[model samples]
Target chain A: MDRMLSADEIVRGLLAKEFSAAEVFRSSLERVRRMDPALSAMLSVTEEAGMAAARAVDECVARGEDPGPLAGVPVVLKDNMCYRAAPTTCGSRMLERWTPPYDAAVVTALEGAGAVILGKTNMDEFAMGGSTEYSAFGPASNPWDPDRVPGGSSGGSAVAVAAGYVPVALGSDTGGSIRQPASYCGVYGMKPTYGLVSRRGLVAFASSLDQIGPFARTAADLARMLSVIAAPDPGDGTSSRRARPEYGAAVASASLKGRKIAVVRELAGMKASLSPDVEGTLARVLDLCRREGAEIVEVSLPRSLEFGLPCYYILAPAEASSNLARFDGVRYGFSRKERTLKALYERTRGEGFGPEVKRRILTGTYVLSSGYYDAYYLTAQKVRQLMKEEFRKAFASCDLIALPTAPTPAFRKGELVDDPIQMYLADIFTLPVNLAGLPALSLNGGFTADARPLPVGVQLIAPQWGEEGLLSAAAVLERHLGPASVAPMAAVKGGDGR
Target chain B: MTVSERDVRHVAELARLHVEDDEIVGLVGHFTGIMAHFNALARAGEEGRLPLDDLSPVVFAHDEIPPLRADEVVESSVGRAVLDAAPDAREGFFVVPRIMEGDE
Candidate 1:
């Protein structure tokens, strides 16, 4: 069973002349070619461009020049993250043929670090849905069980890493897009502190909540990739200038000695809401922390968890409605032929966007409407502030907070597609962190009791700019979890019979 | 608060999405189901009624002032390519339906 090499192994091997960077890239694309038809994880594969990038790395090595830290590593981009002149569909007809004029800050960073850009991966239409079912292209199949969903709107990126297609892929977390899907697909996904990574070329979903991060099979890869993309960018107004702790060094020197991790009273009381699998996974992770001499104290976040989803729904859509207005036919998205100007605007958007995208745009407009503005949007914002305060007090007693990444494991596809609320509920655990502009790392904690492997994820939430804390904890957890469990038949499973 | 089909229609109009009659049936039900959750938020349960602070909205979570770049005219390499992507384009602008029904 050939597995994709971890980023560290690939870099070391490339330098050691074990294989050329081209071979590593070709191997990755070969696996994509072998498996992606059924999985539908990829929207496009930039084979020629990727090969050219690989050649550059190999030439650097051949000429006795230093290849960068992530040399030969292949990265898949969540389609919403722009790559210059590539179709960044974001799984919608609206941007079907649209190519971004510039590369996203993350893309530029990855290329600078010598990572090969494989191509754009599928996502929910404008990253609206929990499952990739909302993807206009198609649902990305869960690696563990083909019948289940690869939780999205970063589903394709997660599946790519989980199925051993690539070592690293980038996903944006606005609400729980990155973390929940990583939990479902059995990988590590981080939503770095809001301003830690630049949002320069990321098509904005919810500006405040959105942060670009990586999905990887190992915590080491998570840290290494984070180091590359987490630099302050002049291009993004929100990119913070605060000095960042060396992320790679944090993972390398990960320790649990005297680390005070808080278990929130709010999470403890919600045993009934958590699955048996999730409960067991959290308990085991806590036990491991305890064994490592980390103190686990109980703290209270009160209604923070309960109000998180409601607050997120109100605020994200309100922000999305404004950000997505650029898609009018007059600008650069999907234009159409129409008799009247108003009809052109309406018909172009109607025909271009999928059902889920339209639903969100409408919902966003409804939330921002004059009558409902104060009642819904304003209240949600106020609640968001209170939630942030509760977390501030909780962090007073501990170094970081721990919780289940999702309420459950990867749900069977079509199980909740018709139920929009149920789909939104999939992100219940992960959204609270986003609302607070906190850093969270979702990593594979344990597996289910099935005769086969179904991975469960546990998250560590840290205060603003606390990515170092999350990385250290994740590095320790990865050692105990053995290695990420790649689904045996991941290549063959499709949610909707692809 | 109850949401009517008329409300959804108005929202869709504001959003510039012309949804069909059949789609509206599902859209109405979907919006209603979601609002039911918001309705739960409205209900002041023990969890919702917890002593919360009367805090203002923290719009941008980070407080650091954004660093501004020096204004400079940088030629875009993809300007022509962007124009080429338009469904209809002429003279450095995206073309769309004429403003009037009976005009050039």
Candidate 2:
């Protein structure tokens, strides 16, 4: 019943009869009841559903059949991911009451693996913003400091794991959604290579850039989750049909003995605006890589510096504008009364969508509109190609490119809530990878001097369909740097009565 | 850096969003600020490049198919939760206001 157990440890414990699934479930539920109110990490806790699933897992264990790899392990899913019985709101009022008739492909895989579904975590509205401040429900607080924000749109998933609410959770990364939050919250997050995981039931933000990933306390746990979910789904047209790798076994074999790691020169000093604490932590990570026999090379991605963000904004929104058009009050989601069909479309969308969602939709509409299509949307696509080409060149020289996940540590809630541009700039270092559809991971590099737990995440980027190389590099770094020590907030708050 | 009210209205219409007159001014200011930062993408100098579509996996042509399943089964799994949010629904189907006179 100890909180902060890795998902692998929890599964092993349950299998060995160390604790019943019901006992583990109860402990997680208790943790949520005590901690979630302050953290605001979860949008909805599936108490009844979770207990039911746990009981089923216990029964399977008693029957002497292998349940699954992650059997009996509690995990939180980002609210944007569709779950059969849970309301997948995407942290927006637009789909506040929308419930999918079926589970997302990842959910099916996780459930099939016998993982206990704890709840749906909160996120930015439609996973658009870097911070969860854009979430209609409200921002999730970083576990390290209550006043600071947990970097998001995967903030809730990251916080849930960082706070020990769950050992692992599913999060979707379009533009640094998974990695930024992982860095800010001081945990490991991986955005698998695009097409590696199915996006069938995910509420699409940017179809091309979006990929479901996992947040975990350690690399091994992340590998275990990846192995279960990283498989092609026929339902997802964009999903990869490539052979799946044994991620868990690969993690054990990950070694940097002769690995060529590249540090993108453009991104190295781009975080000049970051606090010195974060800068120093990143420096130490580089030092650790050198000590591990990793040959660090400085590679320049000139096109990436200029084109990545622009291409992302244009392409992502254009796709989003189309994907979101489905929620016009006819098929599903919030509706509004109006006399005319046009009025219904307007009123329903206006009433349902939040300010940020509306803004992006408008931007998207403008870019994709007939007159501006060539000038904005088409031009951005071309830029996206150049960005991808630049990445191709960089990969030829090195196995991975290291960079900071976010420009700074977690800022306080409401700090950039009023200013959308300031919030967007937070993903300066992490967006390009998504734009190029590359595999990237963020691990705990080091902490700041203030003891606020500034997580300096080194992003290891590999070519598309190169998840094996990406996870392997991350595993080496995780072992070399050592596991991050995070004190449970429950003990700090005196709530555990320890 | 000033986003005119007319620009805001035009964009709102294009986006299919209905904004109140009072909210327009505030929204214009927010848009202006966001656009200012978005302009950074322009300076990033990535013009004349190809769009993401060029890199897309090839879509094979499909052969002719037989008659599809009846609509009834397709509509069965859609639950009350999805239907309840619809603006108009009757007899387990989404109902819409008349788009044209004499239209069924």
Candidate 3:
């Protein structure tokens, strides 16, 4: 209980009666209370409900029942996912007081697996920004350095794991929300292939792009967390009906022998943007792959690297504009009492949404408006298809493709907050995989050699439904790169508990 | 591509957002900057940089169609809970501002 325990260890210990489930939950809650004040990782801590769930697990164990794979494990969720017990705020004031009526598909899955729901974590308002700075509550500071921003919009979820509040946390990634923040925080985060995870009860951002995934300190924990939630749900039309493999078992004996890993050749052209730490980390990971009997090859993704940002900006916002139209002060959330419907919609949206959400909505509206649809939205879609083709061709000769999760390590908190475009560039390397709808995982490659050493991540992407390959490669890489370490709570510069 | 404040306001109105006049300057700058970057797709197509001339917009990433569940009715017990979460609800219907000025 003194240090962060992985979900696997917690489950085993719970079965062995090494510690009561209530004791484990209390210790994790204690850690959150102690560390999260400075990090601001969680938006709401569901102490009463979490303790109740832990007691239920303890009862099952006492009765000689299995209690399930994740019995007594502590887990946090991004605020976007609905849980009947907690307010589903999505880090926005609009839904600050809204409590979901039902649990998200993943939420139900985790509960069934005996994982205690710790709380909901903060994120960018409506999952639109790269930094949690867009959160209406306030930004979550990087655990490695309080002065630096945790890459987000899943910053809080990433911080929860990195600061040892929990071993596993769920986050939704529309672009690089999970991966970039995981990289910045030095944890393992994965964005499953689109449709592999159910989206039911998850607040829609860009319906097609948003995917709920997990953040964990070790590859095995990530695999276990994913195994529980990767099943199909009837509530979501886009959820895959295919059977999911046993992810934990797949990673347990994974080997990199004879696997072909590809490096993006086009990354050379963008060298000026890549930081030395990130570049060196990628090189070292590749060397590790080579030493593990894997071949490192090169593939070109010229269109994906150069045009993915523009393509994603257009398509994601176009969908977001449509998806967000539901928040018109009518059904739920914050509402303004206006005399007319138009006034109500305008005022509620203008006052309710943050600047980044408003900006994306306006951009989406512009691209999809009259006389502009074919030029921007349609053009971006074509480019997206072209990107898919590029990945398809690249994967024909490689089992996996590796890239830096972000162009650089975590930056100063306010550095790019004012520059929306500059902030978007932080996800440049991770976006193409999302655009292509391929499964990808970000593993902590190494850390920068500074006084406050920020972690850098190496991303591994696989073909559609190729999560096994991504996990297999990650499991092997984790063996060499070493599992990610939890940042000390004292590393935070000034603990004002902002 | 240049996006003026007028364009910004028009787009905001289309999206039903109330943009403050002072914020329009920043909105216009964001619109112009993002559009300039987005224009790269069109430019690449025109320059034949990628094979986009006859490419089709991808509806989904995979080739197989998503399997549909059997068409059947399932009882939902969350109706009352859903209604309870609404900002304003009368009976079972959501209460909203009147749509028509004369009808109200």
Number of clashing pairs per prediction, in order: 0, 4, 0
Worst 10 residues of 1 chain A by lDDT: A489-498
Note the residue pairs that clash in candidate 1: none
Better of 1 and 3 by lDDT: 3
User: Higher-TM-score candidate among 1 and 3?
Assistant: 3
lDDT of each: 0.85, 0.79, 0.90
Report the poorest 10 consecutive residues by lDDT, candidate 3 chain A.
Answer: A489-498
lDDT score, residue A131, model 1? 87
Model 1 misplaced stretches (Cα beyond 4 Å): A489-498, B42-54, B71-77, B100-104
Displacement of residue A53 (Cα, Å) in model 2 is 1.3
- Report the lDDT tens digits of candidate 3 across residue range A209-285: 88999999888999999999999887988888889999987788899999999999989888999999999999999
Clashing pairs in 2: A381-B50, A381-B51, A382-B49, A382-B50
In candidate 2, stretches whose alpha carbon ends up further than 4 angstroms from where it belongs are A268-271, A490-498, B1-3, B34-87, B101-104
The DockQ of each candidate is 0.56, 0.32, 0.73
i-RMS of candidate 2: 6.3
In what order do the candidates fall by TM-score, top score first? 3, 1, 2
Best by the DockQ measure = 3
